[model samples]
Target: MSSVATASSGVSTPNDTRAGASTPWRRVIFGAGVGNALEWYDWSVYAVFAPFFAQQFFDATNAVSAMLSTLAVFAVGFVMRPLGGIFFGWFADRLGRQRAMVVSMAVTALGSLFIAVAPTYPSVGLVASALLLFARLAQGFGIGGEIGASYTYLAEAAPARRRGLWSSSMYVAVTIGVLLATVQAAALQGVLTDEQMTAWGWRIPFALGAVLGIYAFYLRRGLPETTAFSNARDTPEPEKQSMLRGIWENRIAVLRVVGLTVGGTVLFYTWAIGATNYAITVKGIDPDGALWAGVIANLVYIAALPVWGAVSDRWGRKTNLVIFSVGLGALSFPLNWLIQGSVWQLGLAMSVALVVHAAVASILPAMFAEMFPARVRASGMALPYSIAVAVAGGTAPYLRTYLAEAGMPSAFTWYTILLLAVGLVVIASMPETKGKKLE
Candidate 1:
């Protein structure tokens, strides 16, 4: 065993190894994956249902204006992500990953519940809007913490050689959550009248998300703490340093997290969240067909995740990241231009873009976790990563919508290409850390 692994593992006897080995893989994956699914599910459903709920909480005079207002609230939620990361990351380091995860899930569920029960604009006037904003802020905070804690836990708990493969489960769970939202949107659209959907149907998913969050919280509470965190807790230096000092000590890695995420998060939101919106709102595709196509595309994304995870396991993390940045940089514009309003075109474009995205998405947990020692891994990664996603990813849908509305849709395409180019440079500069032992 590597020195780091041995230290993290403590002075393990044969019985200790046997005990660790006996823990079911199903439990590990579920504990981490379910909460992750809840986070993405809530986010995905918000985007999926935003068109339906826009007038419920915002101005009803102009459809486009209301949609933009709803999306702005979506962005507002993301604004809270950095704060969430800081608080939860610190809590994870000071407490345990398991406890932090449990609390995040609870908070996320509470946000969903608030949204589920929130009054419509007609009923409560602008107070409805304020409540919606608060709900999103709470959800953002929960998801922010959820990302850092979950990523850190998944990476540290995996077997050294299979960390990439194991880490891919994070996005597998995420994609599944997205798929669920798409499916629900399609189902709801098919069953409900347009008026019904706009009025009350939009709240169903949020209510369901709250229930699922409760279940995820239960699962996460059962998760065993990672050995790496246990070891870090025992280290005197790490124990003595405050969260800010610990993060400052690892400032270089923090910056790398920001640089690495800038392009990836933008691309992620572009396809994963915004593509359906683009098709329905921009290209005027039928909502039902576009959402179903989104379902298929999400399935393709899910299937591709573990494949790239396994590929990164063999080919190295840097190699997969280079492919992701370069491939996405080259293809983004062409793919964006390819969508000309047909459902099939939208599906193909989304599937192709997401397949490329899976390369980085599959390995992010492992890659980010590898960059820092366990002592500060969650907090070190949380602030920068959340900020990057907030700035780039959160704004993607709004920017794309605004640009397309202005008759310059290609401008957003170029913006994505530029970020991907930046990502390529950062990827080139980063050292390969595949199979590196965790501290």
Candidate 2:
């Protein structure tokens, strides 16, 4: 951010490059943000369109069961996240961060394209469902790799004092992606007939996701390697570069990442994704209403991200994490119960929930990155965080649906509360790294 010049038109563009720096910090943030956006944007596309996908992929059995079955396939992506993290984390650790992102983006694009072109259940039978699962697994692998690499990139590239503000781009861009998915789904519901949406209209969003993934690849390829990564390249012994060896050496830091992420992912998925599904299935709100609620809440969430990050910069990361854990644990049950019926009810509930979660989402990348040195940063961040997402965030919708269908919706609420309590304990036990320079 030193001596950066801006446009005469009063708005800077990506073309505005630094005169002497290797790469402008703004450009680095933009490139990293774009990759994060594509990852979560594709993720929300599936969540927003789950109902349409369920109809197209399964025979007309019990409607709820079919949707749950589809979500189980959706969980397949989550199931692969830990493995993807292991692979991609090592790939990033060995190769450059930019190179890892380019390949990850392609995996997402190909997977999305596969889904966009998949046939209906009647046309291809169980094979259609299999294709859907394959797509999710591919996307899962892509995004799993995406989070650790991208987060490490941002944390490494930013200036020391402003790291939290820069890393907040992760959630700022991700929330924009979430909002786009909801807006696209809402527009489709409003513009298309139900039959049209169920038949072919549902494919438009996935096709668009494919296109964004390609663009993300190009953006990432242009990014220069982080200074930290470049400097640390020759320091580690050859065998230490093996991800398993690094993870073993930094096992404590990795476990802390997992613990910190468990409550945050549960809150994020529950509010950002699970709430939409609940609004439609449990409360019987129309698709349009649920989607619109998602859109509004996500818009608000995007704006709140950097604000929360700034707060964490002053108040401390552990403080924000504690607030997030307590708020979600205390509020989820009542807020979810109050989210029945009207659009205002659902929208208001999600917006409030998002306010609490934005703190965690904004501060998390910086917090995790602060835990380890550049050599093990990517894998240390990825593996533990991915495991938490798989266990808490990925299966949240299915678990909520399943529990509700089994006539025990409150059970899901209690389960979430239990996890948040565990996260709170971890937060209390963790070292506060506010303003601490990355190793």
Candidate 3:
């Protein structure tokens, strides 16, 4: 347990010299990434299989209406995320990062497990929907805390110089989780007929999530509480304020974090999740093809995130975010149009859009975490971030579908672009956080 004294500030920072050249930062990144992946995997299974689940759960004449119902449930899950953020953020700050992570995963695992085993609409009528909603709420609760805890844990663990690279692992894991769900859908589609898919194939992904979540749980068990959290707890008076009070004091920082999160979440859903639905329902691509395209594009995103993160570390967080916002705004409409082209064209469009998305997603964890001090870091970062994500990103797919059904497909794209523009403005106004030590 060697330590380094900050030359400028004279504050002691823990140096991971226990295993020379063997970066503990890597472990921190992997643990946080894995946990986030599991959380996203559990939630994403619902999105990827929404059409099938909608049909199974709700009886509606229009396919869009049924799908809307499914997405509404998905949105409900996100709406609960802020509460999750507050609860788990406080718990992480008070109890320990590892303990908070374990609790979050347990809640998510239980939710996915419930969804995997729940009876269908035919068997249980409204009760089935009630159960599904309850499950999603539970998962949302876990996720609310999961993200902030994971982000703060990784940011605090990494060296200041490499925080961008390490934090990018969170988005890398997110894309990986998305890839896993798409692959699962593709694999399940191969084995089951349309009839079987609607009947039972849809449940397989949820089941898989439960299994994978259990594995993640086991892996996370061995992770240590972050040194920052430990130090915060050990530090004397005035530093020991409640998480809520700290959040109140840092309201402006929370708003800035939320503003940055809005564009990323919206564009992410628009290109990744919403695009999959649009490709299948509007553009007439086969469900399997759409699923495969999503999988491929996500793979590209996962590969590209670390590169962008490293660049951000070298350049600046605000610069990378501005680039991402501008690129995404310029390319979004065209990408949607391209999805209506040939399958190869659709794949190309998605890949490019996601690569652009990688710029913001890669650096967001570090960017947001750097905005607040450690004592209230998790709550300040998680609450507003989750709120923006819930309102903007979570609602994008459903809103886009609704507008499209009302004969305004282009409106959805415009709406996304507007949000991106606002995000860019926010980024322009904010300071670059690169190399800033989290105190």
Each candidate's number of clashing pairs is 0, 0, 1
Better of 1 and 2 by TM-score: 1
Clashing pairs in 2: none
Question: Candidate 1: worst 10 consecutive residues by lDDT?
Answer: 13-22
Displacement of the residue 48 alpha carbon in candidate 2, Å: 3.7
Q: For candidate 2, give the lDDT of residue 100.
A: 80
TM-score of 3: 0.88
Model 2 scores what on Cα lDDT?
0.80
* Model 1, residue pairs in steric clash: none
Sorted by lDDT, highest first, which candidate order results? 1, 2, 3
lDDT of 3 by residue, 1-439 (tens): 2122221223333554111123344555677778788877876788768877786676545678778777888878888998999899898878877788888888888888888899888777878878888999999998888878888878776667777887789988887787787677777877889888888888888887888778778767877776677777788886589777899998888878877888888888877777877777777887767767777888888899989988998999987888888888888777777776366777889899989989989987788888888788888888888888777877787788888789988998888788888887787777878988766
- For model 3, the local distance difference test gives 0.79
Q: Give the residue spans of candidate 3 off by over 4 A.
A: 1-25, 50-72, 119-127
Over 4 Å off, model 2 = 1-22, 50-70, 118-131, 236-241, 284-287, 401-410
